[model samples]
Target: MKQSRLMSLVESVANVIVGYGVAVVTQILIFPVFGLHTTLAQNLKMGAIFTIVSIARSFALRRVFEAIRMRSAK
Candidate 1:
């Protein structure tokens, strides 16, 4: 129980950090090249989008990690 709670907290923090990173990356690498406005509103919108994407990415990565571990054990 305690271990699960700690794991949950770690996962939550990782998601937020990854979301912010993705948002910043989009702003720097993708937005400017495409001429998208980097205003506060746009940034907020992008951040929200990134938060969702990051969560999905995290879950996908977790699955891949599990798969790799399983394959290595076998």
Candidate 2:
């Protein structure tokens, strides 16, 4: 089944949100293993920065793949 552009965008955004949540949760769980103790606010700040970077990376790669797909389709 093929999805429309809007659907693809929605899926991409949802993926980013899910990925961010998983990453943030993992970071909090593993922070103690690295002997770094942090407050909730601090962890959230760090997570936000990482999430932004991840979103950019994901979007860039998605665009690249989509372009390739378009070229192949034609």
Candidate 3:
């Protein structure tokens, strides 16, 4: 079964949304241990930037793999 492009995008977005929350929380907890202090707003902003990049990377990789799968099915 092949996955549609829309589905791939939706999956990527959902995955990133979960990941973004995790990343922000982890940063809040872990940054102090590493002597890296940032405000909540800063953490949220950083997480948002990384989340955008992650979404793009995830979607691109999914597409690449889907293409490979389709090719090999021939």
Candidate 4:
């Protein structure tokens, strides 16, 4: 149980890191080529939005997995 909890924490942290990485990479590397202006404030707002979306997606995926597992058990 403890190991599982630790793994879950690691997964959550990894998601956050990946989310930030995507935000940074897109804003820094891709946006300019597309003629998009991403200032510091815009980056912060985008980061917050992406973080929320990522966490919600993780929870939604976890719930779907749990439901599938329960159905399989029966």
Best prediction by TM-score: 3
Q: Rate the local accuracy (lDDT) of all candidates.
A: 0.68, 0.78, 0.99, 0.72
TM-score for candidate 3, residues paired by index: 0.98
Q: What is the lDDT of residue 10 in candidate 2?
A: 71
lDDT of 3: 0.99
Model 1: which ten-residue window has the lowest total lDDT?
Answer: 1-10
Best by lDDT: 3
Model 2 clashes, total count: 0
Task: lDDT winner between 1 and 2, please give it.
Answer: 2
Q: What tens digits encode model 1's per-residue C-alpha lDDT throughout 1-74?
A: 12243464468568777668767766866777887757767777778787777766766666667667768878
Error of 1 at 46 (Å): 1.2
Alpha carbon deviation, residue 74, candidate 2 (Å): 1.9
> What does candidate 1 score on TM?
0.54
Per-structure clash totals for the candidates: 0, 0, 0, 0
Regions of model 3 farther than 4 Å from truth:
none
lDDT, ranked from best to worst: 3, 2, 4, 1
Per-residue CA lDDT of candidate 2, range 1-74, in tens? 34556666677778878987887788889998999898878888888898778767776777778778888888
Per-candidate TM equals: 0.54, 0.80, 0.98, 0.70
Give the per-residue lDDT digits (tens) of candidate 4, residues 1-74.
12243455568668887878788767877788999878877887888788878876776676667667768878
What is the Cα-based TM-score of model 4? Answer: 0.70
